[model samples]
Target: MTYALTNMRRVLRELRQERPADVPARLWRYAKPKLDVLGEEVLYRARLMGPLAARYRGPGIALMFHEIQSNVDDELRTGCSAGHLRQVIHAVRAAGRDIVTPDEALRRLGDRQSAPFALLTFDDAYADNRLNALPVLQELDVPMTLFVPTGMITREIDAWWLVLRAALRSRSEIALPPMERTFQCPDLASKTAALRQITAWVGTDQARAESLSETLGPLVSDPASLVARYAMDAKDLTQFAQHPLVTIGAHTKTHRFLSQLSDGEVLAEFTSNKNYLEALLGQPVEVLAYPYGTPGACGEREARLAREAGFKAAFTTRPGHLFPDHLKTPHLLPRIDIGYTPQRRSALFSRLSGFQRAMTTRWGAPVAVLD
Candidate 1:
């Protein structure tokens, strides 16, 4: 208990300080496949339908992903890579579980008796989905949703994380071309502090910042060229939509946090992304995945906005299974974050178990607290 208290203190200290100098590495790459080659007891435990079935009273869990590409180099750098997609696919298949599609996942979430299931959903709509992730899923006959920020189609621009990377590099003499300074914190401590400060700002006001980025983005040197180099274009998206396993979902117009924005602003972000996707793909884009998807990123108000915006369902980063009561706000679907590294598996399973325990008891236990 004292150690837990001490750990909490340290976390609070860190949260109170500036952002991490390293930008906390946007996504972590798996150093190796998470599963044991010889197959360990963990795998055996994972296979047991009883513990999970008894532990998780709901229907099933759904997983969240961003980008999956063949280029390990790019993936390692971005933190959103699914380098072990095949390994993951094999594991899921061997487990003999169903890979539910987005529509089916939502429908079942609204049905308590629906079978145990999982669904794969990706965000950011990178070109690599078509080039890399699509083929494997197709081969496996797995259905997935590709949540795209439709505005990126015409303009090739880096995601905010990439922009932060570029900004970090600009401060270093890393042999990369110079980028326009977004915020100057001078030294590492200051940089971390700046990021922490900005993280709070983002949590509180991401929409304004996103809007500001757009006007100021062109002012950054080689804007068009940079966008071209990092993002998927309209042509790329059109090509991606051609796949049978790929269904389109909205990720807001520019991936702004809907909760931080005004009601109208939230509506604008949702409607814009939905309308843009519809116009681009010639179909209704009904599913939604909140940007960040974390608890603080958006909340009840935004969940209501998603339903009012005509989304049949929406998703969040909250890790758990879904049932009808869970879909009281059908738009606020909770998802599990599957990590690339083997080290993450234990933590993932632990978190899942903890979540199942908390749900069953309905105790207001704090799994974690900042301060």
Candidate 2:
């Protein structure tokens, strides 16, 4: 019992530092199915109470996905297996919701329609989106929006978070001169903690973080191969943009958190990426998905700049369903991140059904606030 208690504490410490973004969700992952079942029961009971219950239902929902691949060993945790992707589509449709493009959902919400709808969005321009997700989406005949970080395509930069993680995983010790710190990463737990600290520093001081990373030299033996393996290059982006059912959107120039940048930096990030995407795709790019997409990563200032830069809308990683009130503030749109676990099907449905949103509001205010 003493040994078990010690192990538990060690696990908690590692999780607290490494996965701060989704600590509660990660802790509840295993028990999610039971909670989802309870949520569904509550919803069913509410529906039995008559038309008043229907009023709480959201008109539309936008689902966010990162990578769609079966490879379990990938460093990025934001991927759902291809099989789960298919199941998610089937489950959403089975629940009697119409899957629509982000544009259509926006238009319909403006028209004040109460019909349930869903929108699919892919972020970071991962190659798996084309290689794995596209076939599933095409087979289901669903439309999706893909947000690209133009710098990734041009090879001007790679995702610093990925690079940091790779380095911590490979090396036993790393030095962070900016913070005057050194980390011992002899195991996955220590490496994760090291990654968390480094990532926070990167988020705060990207330039210094970049210099430090470069000073440390290549994390992986083959830097070029790593970039190609993770991100879509210019040629890949060109072909992906031509997909009839895919809508291309800008995700900034370097995939940096807008909230960390100055107004001028934010504007340049939006305009530069939008211009490059529009020129490459030969279509108007009017939507933006903030990198990181969380409240801390993007806020009112970033959203305003996005609109001023000629974008029609912007998305955040906030978990919620879309309401008519959201149309008033299109730039601050909320989205639900799909799970990567095998049993995420139920959790996906729970989110799509608005049960989670409803429960979330029961404790506090609604997830989607009116403008």
Candidate 3:
């Protein structure tokens, strides 16, 4: 669900039509609380485990991570802090469980699995992962997969979200052309409404790109020119991949929402990244993670593309544990999100006690089959 937020503009647009008057603040308030409550419940459940049992473990679990930076202040933007990453590693280690590599996990899975296992994964290839997260993983000798969007390898901050957030923060009454409307509000209200309306534009990749350029072009410091930045260069990736503890996967070329694209475009996005990563690593990159990893982000069609592209496995942002039945479709695996928020505790707990599966079946039924 949180992964789907890459398309914030699309969500806000829906809210605008449903509640034209007060969509932004209302949506923000409404959305985070539900997330928070779910988190709390998940954590409480996790803490209830009696003692770690090695033999009775269920299925192998994969945890998804985003940015992990030194100063925890900007943690909100990245979905996690260095402290959180450390804590998560510590928790998994203290439990005396094993941290399995993607290949090891799959091999064991092919053999009908052993005990419960875990694979730590990072998404959206951020520079901070090298500086903050990678060191921790290295020190602990943990195996992890870092999924990159390829486009961000030589780019600065994630350009799309930077623009979307700025537009949401602006109090200036601006007319959004694509929606064929101008938002009018006295103060923050208008800004929030604008955010709500604009989010809906993320329904399609082209719409997402255009809407971002339109809303953030004026606000971003230097929108006219493309700035060269390093998320993780070929050298960084090569060093990590050679570490024997790190694996790399393709996260598409442009980070566009896959569900919004046509079959041909989806194939291009999936295969291009796979080919790029394989070339960079000098190995067969058989795994893929959907951009955004949401129902609206990449649906059945996109899953087929990943399979057709010869990817052995594909991951989604849906929170839950993996079961043998889950192996039916290698292109659709359930991954638990380990975000920066305190709710991570909840998420971990939910996974341990099976609350995540329960909640996913109840509230997230659409993707239950995918899981």
Candidate 4:
């Protein structure tokens, strides 16, 4: 029992330190999250789950979203419908919670006396966020944290995902001579599979541009053009960046997976993007959401780099509710991704509950070493 306890502590420590994992650490990372989610669901079914009561009150949640638009005519789908976004906000309000900015949410971690709240954060700065999500937020009268990729807005980074997605939809077959694999995308399911496989192999947006160009030829032409079409530009954000409803956070410059980069490269990605966004927006960009916020894509090393680069907080796409302990490791914060969930109260409530967050995360909250 003592041995198991020590191993569990070590797994959490590795999450904090980003060291190469042992088998136990690997299992904890992959298994624990699933177990947590299952536990929450099981408890709910058993009627053992309660409301957002005192046990779950101090630190609430940070909801993650991308492309909250509805353009049926457009090939690339929104992560969820704009109407669903309205429902989410309504549900949160019905549960008697406040939706706050990122700063407020992080502040609540330390101020246990603060009210129960949730933070809405949109990643990738999709143009639809402005056109679709923003209006809905306006009608609802709440704020959002927008994580922007400075390079993509500046046309310095290719909106490679947009290009690749379009390519997948238009082309019936995709041939990769280098990998010696040809994907037959005859329908939506096959096309989605092909896109996923290609994206997994392509890895980062930085590498995807080069890999797709080399293997697929001009199949993905002018990623900048795709950016202009799908993503919000610097000019579009010029007005919105200063708005009261929006809080702009850095989403790195090129959207590369920072965990895969060296210390120097990681710092460069954070610092350069921070400097860029600060200069462009004329506001102190104090927070970040690590690009590809997974254990493999971003861990403790990346979070430390973010802190060293002078960000007040950095977020990951890990599942969990915030807790006062998060104050100890501000940069390694976890957020719940609200992907394509239907406009059902049950679905929203399942995600909103503290029991769920507790179960869905490997560790309930981030652990930090005392000085």
How high is the lDDT of residue 30 in model 2? 30
* lDDT, candidate 3, 48-160, per-residue tens: 43232222234677789886766542222435677788788777666555788788777766666376577899987767777888778878888889887777764633456
What lDDT would each prediction earn against the true structure? 0.61, 0.75, 0.67, 0.73
lDDT of 4 by residue, 233-292 (tens): 888887788778999999988887676678999899898899988898899999899877
Q: Write the per-residue lDDT of candidate 1 for residues 124-194, one digit (tens) a residue.
A: 77677677787788888888888888656656333554454344434522111222224543344334333
- For candidate 1, what's the RMSD? 8.7
Error of 1 at 327 (Å): 2.6
How high is each candidate's TM-score? 0.69, 0.78, 0.76, 0.78
CA shift at 346, candidate 4, in angstroms?
4.5
Could you list the CA RMSD of all candidates, in the order they appear? 8.7, 5.7, 6.4, 9.9
RMSD of 2: 5.7
Name the runs in model 1 displaced over 4 angstroms: 1-54, 71-77, 80-82, 110-113, 156-158, 169-204, 207-224, 339-343, 348-371
Q: Which residue pairs clash in candidate 2?
A: none
Once all C-alphas are superposed, what RMSD does model 3 give against the true structure? 6.4
lDDT of 4 at 110: 76
Q: By lDDT, is 2 or 4 better?
A: 2
lDDT measured at residue 161 in model 1 versus the true structure, 0 to 100: 49
For model 2, the superposed segments whose C-alpha errors exceed 4 Å read 1-56, 168-217, 342-346, 358-362, 367-371
